[model samples]
Target: MASSTASLISLQSRPSMAVARISTAKPVQGRSFLSFGLRAIPSRRLRVSCAAKTETVNKVCEIVKKQLALAPDVAVTGESKFSALGADSLDTVEIVMGLEEEFDISVEEDSAQNIATVQDAADLIEKLVEQKQKA
Candidate 1:
């Protein structure tokens, strides 16, 4: 009787594990469908804004290269991180100051600290510039 009971318990646990696997698999399918739906909806809006963002990113790359005193041969892009370009904390502060002067927008200390990449700084600059225009 004891052996029979243990076998039954194991059988019961196996089905639960199978159910858990099925549940997890289902959510993965649901998420992919949700993401596809989201992408289709935003494509038009994203294309419109992407053009302006690309221009901002290009300008930011130029500023980052100049601020870091990089050689002309060195390439800077939106994806380039400040630390990877040899910018320490002080260098980063100076870069922020340069961006402020170039963009004619004041960056809050907290917002400045969040800028780890040229893209980040460009996005923040654009946001601030937009806010200033609205005001």
Candidate 2:
């Protein structure tokens, strides 16, 4: 009898945890409302479209191939590595600079060093563009 009542109370409390209700009080304008009583504010994520990503990759590839002076016979895909494409350190730097000028975004030194493949450069460019738009 007592144990059954305790179990019922626990079950009822569990449902409250599952369902969330917004308070009737309106949140201040231009501010995000917090869910439940959590202290951590959730961050808003920027959504990137597939077409935008593809366009970035194509543009990056074009810059890389042109900067490296690669022949048209050579195919540059996302998986193609900079080294395999005959891009040395200087060429890589030039390519990064070209990307900056084309995308109108600054690339940090650490991030520039991390780009080893076409896909990597494209992904970094996309991220930089997204951050720029958000700011």
The lDDT of each candidate is: 0.71, 0.75
Highest TM-score among the candidates is held by which one?
1
What tens digits encode model 2's per-residue C-alpha lDDT throughout 1-135?
A: 111111112124343332233333335675544343312223446854333377778888899889998898889987789999888999999999999999999999999999898888988888888999999
Summarize candidate 1's per-residue lDDT along 1-135 as a digit string, tens digits: 111111112124333321111111224534522111111111122321222388888888888888889999998887789999999999899999988998899999999998888878888888898999999
Residue 61 local lDDT, model 2: 83
Best of the candidates, lDDT: 2
Q: Report clash pairs, candidate 2.
A: none
Those runs of model 1 whose alpha carbons end farther than 4 Å from true positions after fitting are: 1-52
The estimated TM-scores of all candidates read 0.62, 0.61
RMSD of each: 13.6, 14.7
lDDT of 1 at 103: 85
